[model samples]
Target: MDKINLSVTIAVITMFISLFLSFFLVTVKTEHKLSNRLFAFFLILNAIDISVNLGYFFDIPLNARVFISSIFFLQLPAFYLYVLSVCYADFKLKPKHLIHVSTFLIANLILLPRFYTVSLASKISFLKKSSSMLEIQFNHVLVHIQIILYLIAAFMILRKAKKIYLENYAGASMESLNWLFQFTVALSTFYFIALLKNIFKFTEYPDISESLKIGLFLFELIIIFWYLYKALNNPGLFRNIDSRLKLVADIVSEDKNSAQLIDSEKEYNEDLLKLKSYMMEKRPFLNPSLTIQDVSKDLKIPVRDLSVLINHKLEQHFYDFVNTYRIENAMDILRDVTKSKVTVLEILYEVGFNSKSSFNTAFKKHTGNTPTSYRKSL
Candidate 1:
């Protein structure tokens, strides 16, 4: 086999092994409905990617090349969909999404005839020789379009998912978001390399092709392993450890006398105080959905202790505490004569309220007046 074929063979093997392990881990550990479906979809995409590499390795027939190219064109959108599903459980696939998928499919169908007419060897030779400015520009345009679409989808879901996690599962949510952000960065790097490869092709700098391929392969392997490690080692990777500890303390407090639980409670309280102080400094409460769990993770405090401190010492529920800060910040914004001209909705969002309704309700509860009235009074 040629050097390129040999490298492709090794890359294909690595991807196949990673794919197999990923599937096994997902099947064994995934419990959430959306996560399971996303994993399944991820597996399918990986399968297609592997098949494309395999077909190329063997110098498959021109018809096989056409099939593989179609699959390749579909892979990016599938990957973005998988990312969305993993990050957002409530994300529903819509008709508009289907339309987007169909567009890529139809475009591939239109090009398939041309793809099949070219011999496999001749196609490879053409790819190596072609430096046509028009073709390069066309490919670059397609690459940018894919990148834009993927980014829009990934970022939209990430923003919503981050809020949901913070509000609903605060203590563990920070860790989850941290990991998610890292994953996104890694994926983005891979896409960037792909973009660069297309640019190099357009610019007739074919020497970078091998380097791009290697980088792409390495990045994919890293992503697959990172995901598999999280899946297998901590299926509940997103759960807050501090919160679980606090729950234990709470249950024990209920069964024991105040005196008996005093020392333990005191220790827990001290830790919780440290955590709260850290969060106060960070001011994550600026996020309307920020919760006790997120604060705990940010401060590295046990979730249970954070819960206990908020519930017992502060005498406020988690959501109430978060909204209190959000409202307080909103008040400051409302009172600023220079910036007070900003709309109520703008102030609401500026202070971390996700919706105008929540901001209005929280402001009314905190200050006994609507934001507009408060602004006018100011």
Candidate 2:
């Protein structure tokens, strides 16, 4: 094998190994259904991508051609599902969902015969003296269609993910969504480069195909490694690191005869109740900027501890918990004849929402009815 092919092979192997480790680590460490399932799906898709690369590297046989062609079509839909899982924080696999996936698969099946026939024709042309221009043109057109379909799927996923990020969600969830968006963008860019290289293949470019393949392999390697690192590590890695330092300090201080401070249960309970009463009376969730940090400062608690309290005791994330309060207030407003002069948008803004779209989305999600529909029903 040439240096370029050897390099591409090593890169593909590294990506496969990283993906394998990530699959195992995520399975062991993550309990989140959506994240775990998405990682598993990514592992499968990465395997398919690697197989396709391997076939090109080896100039493999007709069977390899067919296998690669089939797997090529699998990448985009798997990626779309992965993005959906990250955005929603839920991976509910239903028959309807499977049906949607199968539709994409069916499209792949339609394209497969054309791909294999064209690949076979190209191989035959290389062996025989006679090859038609039409055969090569057909192959080129099919590949372009495949690239376009992949791009369309990726774009749709990105659009949905962006919408989810703009909606009120926990910081971690938002970060995850952004990460997926950036990853998809990177993948799209690499694919775009491949499309360009394909367009220029007939030109007398110096080893451009080899260079483009190596670039793609490196891109895949970087993405796989980055994603694996993020997935394997704990979500609150920095927080855990800080907690360990604090624990060591506590231990050393005890040995040094340092003063011990104890929190008073009575005072803590009183403060907790006071905060709850204020929230109930004033309903600060109506403030669009209300966040765990805001509440932590107002209530004199550490932000992490407050997050723990909400997640564990309240059984909801900060955003959902806050929105519940806002929706309750909205419900009351909708019921009041005195508030009949208030517009839906006015009520949405009054209750701490910055955007009518966000308010409508939250209202529908919480109540299973849009604000306008709910008001009409009332």
Candidate 3:
């Protein structure tokens, strides 16, 4: 048996953390009840899957290890479902939920002959072969296809949800499912890295696969931190919001600071002025959930016009334009001696940024300094 490494020890700890949190969510009276259950399942599967991987470092029996291979296939499905449940407050899984997980089910059916039908020694051998079994070959293609399709679907769900949320969900306390968006992006990046690792191994790209193990380590950190952060700060994101979220309920108090309205020239130029004025006056950028539609409603301008103003005239997309304003706002606050007592995180929220990464990126992009250093300079 291989000696246990420090990395494996840390991973085991993270695995238990996920397990503990999953149990909490499973038992809690959460907001998004259905979504929370689904997310907890995601966490449980992931924790156990990692546990099984770590098992090889210890004294795990072969039969038990082989039996647990099925959990890996279930992970893709569980992750996809979690994303769906969180993004769609109204989402519920029915008997049809099986279809989303059908690949894992099918994988298990096909893999059964090797993992179960064989002796312990033979089962281990079968698992080691690169492409000797039909099931193994099918798994490669299936996993790649499944990942691409599900990632696209997940991103589409987020895109649509953001659009709809900004348009109608004024009282949601959160403008966008910001944490969930980061979660999706992080999930996608994780898969991409894993796929890359597979490609390197298949292609026998020298020591690339060994280097890619670092990628896997980074992915573990991403999942652990992302899950813990969201689980701590915004438990409601995982709650089964259902019809209870009163989509337009008493417009969550708009920033007392008020949103500015802009004016532009005729045609596209007119859009430019209108968007600029609205941006300046309304400061809609301060709303992390602020979207083109949200700005449209506030400015009484069409979404397309606002898009054109940002895309063509401003030479920036809506996201960048908004971040520009947010970064500038952060700078103003950071430079003020009166606000010196405010923490960086508090200022991030004050300027409509929900995440440190987003705040730091925008801050560094515009000011060429991180939030802390920028403030220190002033």
Candidate 4:
């Protein structure tokens, strides 16, 4: 098949898949309903954008085609908002969020006087000379700006969210946003390909530019199918941390030389003892889904204090601190002759670890041997 036919076929497949996924996300029951709905809206906007390429085949009206092309302005904002929703469970759509779509509204208004309001013959003339039109050039600039700003914003949000999860939650919670991270990486790849296509559009090689466009559609098809796989396999992937939670490093920076931050040696030792006592007696590490806040409440300590104690004073993340205790317990079980009949899998679960791979990793870190090797040596 020729380039146009191949590109059209891929676009059709991608749009249908994106539409199906969007509908599925909207209808699916999930704790992150707002996130799902936002992502579904993003997918719908993507479908609209893809439909822009097929307008010529269908003899679409010029006015309608011009209006639909404005969908480009909305795509990045919708995607950025979806990232925000996924990062924070408490995220809600408010009047303030409408500001994100201001560019899309402005783009339509800019087209109104020159293209939308013109007669049919004038509109045709405008299209034939659109590349030279100041309004069209300005819109192109806005799209490039959106592409850079929104994708960078999404990456920043994901990076911060991942850090918070690692510092405050157990090892099992580390991969909660892994799927979203992969999705963002895929989205970035799509934008990079588009950037290349735009650069090549003005070059001497027309065939190379057209080939890049077709390659983009092929990439889109791959991404949509990947999304389907992740959505089906990891339905509960959107676990979120409280957005208000601040990192221990930020807290320390604010009070770096405060007397309260530099507690008396006695008080420092006392807090350490208290934390160790609670861990031993309560075995909170065995909870599998434990977070620093959960331990703070149980110990009647402030989350900030607990964070400082474990994360800064102890020089370990809350995840690492908890897993250390879990690994110690697993070692004891591995050495115990009475529990020799118990499998390594059973011992890992009994000691509060949910995944065998993580359990084995922690075990190796704590002891220089795997669980089975450690048991056999005993």
Candidate 5:
């Protein structure tokens, strides 16, 4: 097939696959209903929205054109909700959100009567017209404005959320928002393509060729597949992290009465003392993959309090702080070679170091000797 027809084939196949996956996720996946539903809704709307391009390429019948405008209205809202559901489970669609959603409903309802009356040939002729009516051009501008607003709102939320996560958590392996960050970039690029296609319609300029729309849809296909790959492999990645972050958000945000006044420094010092006592007594650092949140929970202290105490006051990330304790334990075990009969690797694992390299590095830094050497010297 030629370049034009190739774009059509790719666009149709990609959109079809996207629509199919959305259906499959909603019906088959029980893990994250809210996230999946929102995602599926978003994709389905895109599938419908791109039908205009498909109509241009193939003579596919679009008997009812006006109702399809509703898909445009729903696209942004659906995507915005998908971000919220994926990023924050506690965030439900409140009545305030309903106000935004009503715009989609109203846009569709207002245009439905006029669109129903128009034939496919008229719609095609309107597209072919070098100078369409002002109303159509304005509507195109309004649609783009709506999309830009929604994209900005979603990106702001995701950016803030990612900032908060980085502040509270230290491990890269457990972080789930990395894909989300990339998703935002892809979505933003897709909007840029859409804007280019729609922007000049309001001007005296002749409408661009079907090639631009074809290229636009082709890029969209790539984005859809990328999204599908990430979503299918890690269906509940976002939901899982959302609930986790929510649990500790209060603790991580204000750090337990950040504004509470009553000898603030003295109170913090006292909490720090209590925290140190708990750490010494319980030795919770012996557990692998221990987090500040875990220690906070064990001490019945706010996660914010523990985070502030460890990260700010003690001047160590939670990872290093835990490993510090682990190294100390390993040194003690190394010195007590008479009772333990433990190997260096055993000491490493027992003290919560995930690997020997990390354990030796920590041990040597603090003790000036490897676990084996330290034991030998003893």
Candidate 6:
């Protein structure tokens, strides 16, 4: 296909998929209602982005194209908020969230008199010399600024959320967050390449700029398809972590100079022994959806202290700590001559793992053998 035809075809496909997913996400019944709606808004914004490009391909009127392009300012904000909502269960759309779009509002106000209120002929002439206009250049620079700032914020939230998930819950939570992590990294990479493409457009090589645009279009199409496949396969993947939960490491660093730190250090060995005894006797890891809060409640220990005990004192994440006991439990089962006929799948569930892949991974990590191999070795 010709370059224009190929770009148009890709844009059309991307726009439709985004719209479809936006509708589905909004209408679908899920526990993560806030996250779903925010994600839906992000998808709709993506669809709008595709529509702007498609308008250029079809030679839409300058006035309409200019108006449509204004929405470009909202895309990064929507995506950043979506990331926040997906990561934090307590996330809400407070009025303060409007601050994120201050740039968009400022951009519109800057254009109100210079472009938006101008006559059609003036608007045409303005765009003709837009390459040299200070306001136009400022807006372009502002877009790159938004991309960098929002991408950094989104990544920070995802990183904190992953650490919180690891230190609290065990089961499919990590898998859900892994999908978001991969998606964030992939989207950030796309933005980086698109940034490079935009920079290349200003160079003396028009042919290279055109090739980069085509490559970006193809990359965007592939990303959208990958998202669709992952979303379908992991429909219940929107697990959330409490935003208020602080990591044990963060807590320690913040309190390093406090008297409480000295006291906590004194109790470290006692707390470690107590935690180990509880794990051995209670076998709480047998619960597939176990969380650190459950243990805290059962042991009458403060959640923060319990987190320090498992994560800081034990020198392992709550996930790895719990999985270690689970693997040990599975080992006992594997060594049982009486249970020799039991399948590896059955044994994994019996020992509290929810998925064969995770069970196998944890097993190998702890035992240096797959469950089947461990069983056969015995």
Tell me, by lDDT, which candidate is best. 4
The models' CA-based lDDT, in order, is 0.63, 0.61, 0.68, 0.86, 0.68, 0.84
lDDT of 6 by residue, 1-378 (tens): 498788788778878888888888888888888887887888787788778777745878776677677787898899888888888888889999989888888777788787878888888889889988877898899988988998888888888899998999986778777778788888888888888888887788866777777787788778878877877888877778889999888888877856465455557777777788989999899999999999999888889888887888778999999999999999998898998898999989999988888899999999899998888777
What TM-score against the true fold does each predicted structure earn?
0.56, 0.53, 0.61, 0.91, 0.69, 0.91
lDDT of 5 by residue, 186-246 (tens): 8888778767766554455524634566777778778877877866775545642334553
Residues forming the 10-long window of minimal summed lDDT in candidate 1: 239-248
lDDT-wise, the better of 4 and 6 is 4
Q: Candidate 3, which segments miss by more than 4 Å at Cα?
A: 1-4, 57-63, 128-130, 172-176, 203-207, 236-378
Model 5 bad stretches (over 4 Å): 56-63, 109-131, 167-174, 199-209, 240-259, 262-266, 276-293, 307-378
Off by over 4 Å in 4: 256-262, 333-347, 356-378
Clashing pairs in 5: 251-304
Error of 6 at 239 (Å): 0.7
Model 2 agreement with the true structure over 72-163: per-residue lDDT tens digits: 55566666665655544444566765644553355445544444446667645542531234434444565567667766776776565443
Q: Return the lDDT, model 1, position 163.
A: 46
Candidate 3 CA-lDDT value = 0.68
lDDT of 3 by residue, 190-293 (tens): 88887888778777583586466555765776687767776777654442223332222122222113442233355666666777887889888777666566
Count the clashes in each prediction. 10, 3, 17, 0, 1, 0
Q: After superposition, how far is residue 219 of candidate 1 from its true place, in Å?
A: 2.0
How do the candidates rank by TM-score, highest first? 6, 4, 5, 3, 1, 2
